[model samples]
Target: MRADRLVSLVLLLRRRGRLSATTLARELEVSTRTVLRDIEALSAAGVPVYAERGRHGGFELLPGFRTELTGLNHDEALALLVAGSRRGAQVFGLGSALASAMLKVVDALPESYRDTAAGAVERLLIDPETDLLSRRLDAEDLPDTIVGEVRRAVFAGHKLRIHYEAVGQAPKWRTVDPIGLVTVREQGYLLAARSGADRTYRLSRILAAEELAEPAQRPDRVDLGRAWQERSVQFRTGGDPVTVVVRVNPNRREELVGTAVALLAEEADADGWLRLTVTFQDSRHAEWALWQLSTNAEALSPQGLRAGLRDRATAIASRYATP
Candidate 1:
């Protein structure tokens, strides 16, 4: 609610005097424009919030002004309580801060709700490292120092200088206006723009990062979900996409679809096998997917792929024959 957010905005300024709109937005998880509007709303409501103008200028509350408003309700506190103890967003480098905030919330909670909230959080699990199969989920080992720097830049709305190592390429320096940060399946990505063109960088691939003081070139209000979706579409359609048809054991169907960009079709065969048409990033990706299935899968078309697989098998057989 705007009212709850306004109270938070004021409280933030009270605690950390003279915070920039960008910083407040980062803390409140809103857009800087929204933060600016909230500041205006506070001023209109006769709050002693004043704005200073200059390089280090920001909004600050008048000394001695106090409010007894508790911005959070039972549900709000519990929601934040749950998220504060989770491991999901820790990849963005706010772990300690989250823990501290959770502590404060717990302390401020009504005595009746404190124990209940704690009990509720204890029953829930999030972002576990291992799955039901006992297989460990892949998590990028990101350095805290680098991620902290990048996180600061993204929230501060500043240009970022990164020493990046893209796949199959040497390390290079690149400056970008960071739009947002995203983590998927335990991997982190920075959504940014370079020279007005959208670009995405893997956090694990960043060799180094420096937050620039210069303001970023970006719209004030951002919809990260929409931006990410558009980028994902471009990536899926722009690659050297290859469609391949293959027959696989029904039990291993998931293994095949998991690596594919798109599953075009699927049907069962008379022999109890499954025929699937899937799209991969490229011929190499298709070839690799089929090879992983070993004898359980066969390419139904694209004779080049069949010949390639057969040649590979022949070499393997020859290596073992009478050796």
Candidate 2:
């Protein structure tokens, strides 16, 4: 815990410039004395951290201290700049600083590398329609901490104890033999072996984690990447497939099929309407599709699904009806 706090304090100082011992203590939930001790330890470790004593003074880095990066190529440099720019936009009080730092790095690059960097920056684009900031699945949004542990365990061939909350299930503590971590759809997941069985746990759902003293023996032929791909396939396949036929107005036909859910087939009627046969994982998908289509599409399928849609539509229509 002390080590974790110390590391967090270092990162906080790096990101926020400087803070007083009292402020650091509050942020780390430690005593002021502990913060002072940590500062001393950091200074001993050649961090160049120092305290300023005065009404308007706190703690600050020794003058001329700077973070240095190495081994970055032209494309890599541009990619870093683009990423920093995007993050700066999302985070308040950070954009201008990040942009300025990126500019310094770009300006320092040789002329031979500048054109490549510029081209890479122009090609790096993010879709504004997509939600960049997603809701946190776990109570504590400590992805970096979780990821760091996973990487260490995987490298050391160690076991881990994790408190996890599975979807629709109560939180429970479990022991896992660390294998590898996977990133899917902007979420980090752990592919670990528990009780001789391989399983994937979303890192976001991990409440807490700790490394075990004894390392577990990894399988000789463990293919971490393949395991993640197989698990993804299984997840997508487990959902109950439901077929729904919808009649959409010709003008709205393209919109109806352009949804995220997989579409099976579509046929146009002579009267300028389209009949689409689509298969979705669950009723939620069907509901979303109907919502997107609004009045232009009608569900025609298994009696139960059709009736449910009709009921929902009736309720929604009644809300806007004349009193």
Candidate 3:
């Protein structure tokens, strides 16, 4: 572990040119004394590290000294830099770690490829808070302490006690064996088993979490992709779903089908539109999704949904007419 810390310290100095022991201590998450010891170790090992005295001076590497870490090609370096630019890791409380790792990755690249890769990354913007439609993409609000506890339980194979607040339900405490943590669409989830029955909890909804001393009751090896897919299928089908039959333009069929949980049946109409029977999470979901298409989509069955759309349209028309 000290070796790893020494390597990190060298990379930090190599990238930053010079940094104070206080800065190195903070960056390495170690005390200044540890940093001093590591610096001495590096010097005694024939590394070209030298110290400076007084304010605005600390440690610097001798000029032209480079680590033998030039393995990344141009595209590979670009990929890592671009990935580091995204805020997805913030949800998992790994943002700072990702940043530090990225710094090491960039510093490890061959000098010839470094500036070009960094410049290319600067030209691209990813996951900006606001998009062209003025719609904002905000990070999830997950307490770092809660995420850290759940993460530890999942990694250490320990059972966990969590206070969860499911939608339309009171907050209650549950002990579960955590299978894994997942982030989808900027939302975090914990896939676990309670009494050997699979369950999922959103990290944002976890009011509190405690790692238990007992070992978790889970398989030694887990295929996260398979587990997530299985749970997703169960969640979609198990909910109280609302079915709708609609006639939509052929061009918009994919959009309609995408918004629905499943497409039960499809028929092509003479007017170049599609007759689709679909299932949604609920009536409100069906109405809201279809409403986005305006008149391009029409509810054929479920008179209640059609009436609801009509009422909404009437309200809109009345407001415009009044002007």
Candidate with best lDDT: 3
Can you rank all candidates by TM-score, best first? 3, 1, 2
Lowest lDDT 10-residue stretch of candidate 1: 82-91
- Regions of model 3 farther than 4 Å from truth: 1-70, 315-323
lDDT of 1 by residue, 1-323 (tens): 89888988887888889998888889999999998888888888999999899999988999999988964676877798877766656778777888888889999988888888888888878767898989897877788999999999999999999999999999999999999999888888999999999999999999999999999999998999999999987776676888899999988899999888899999999999999999988777788889999999999878888988999899989999994
Model 2 clashing residue pairs (backbone): none
Residue 283 CA error for candidate 3 (Å)? Answer: 2.9
Off by over 4 Å in 2: 1-73, 83-108, 111-140, 184-186, 196-198, 214-229, 249-265
Q: What are the per-residue Cα lDDT tens digits for candidate 2 across 1-323?
A: 66666667777787777698888889998899998898888889788887777885677777667655344566567777677745323212234567788788888888888778877777776533355586443222345556566567777888888899999999999889888766544456678888887688877788878887797656855776778778766664457777788888888876766652567887887888888897666777677777777778788776777788788889988999977
Which of the two, 2 or 3, has more TM-score?
3
TM-score of 2: 0.55
**lDDT, residue 186, model 3:** 79
Off by over 4 Å in 1: 1-68, 71-74, 249-258, 265-268, 272-274, 292-296, 311-323
Better of 1 and 3 by lDDT: 3
Clashing pairs in 1: none
| TM-score of each model, in listed order | 0.71, 0.55, 0.73
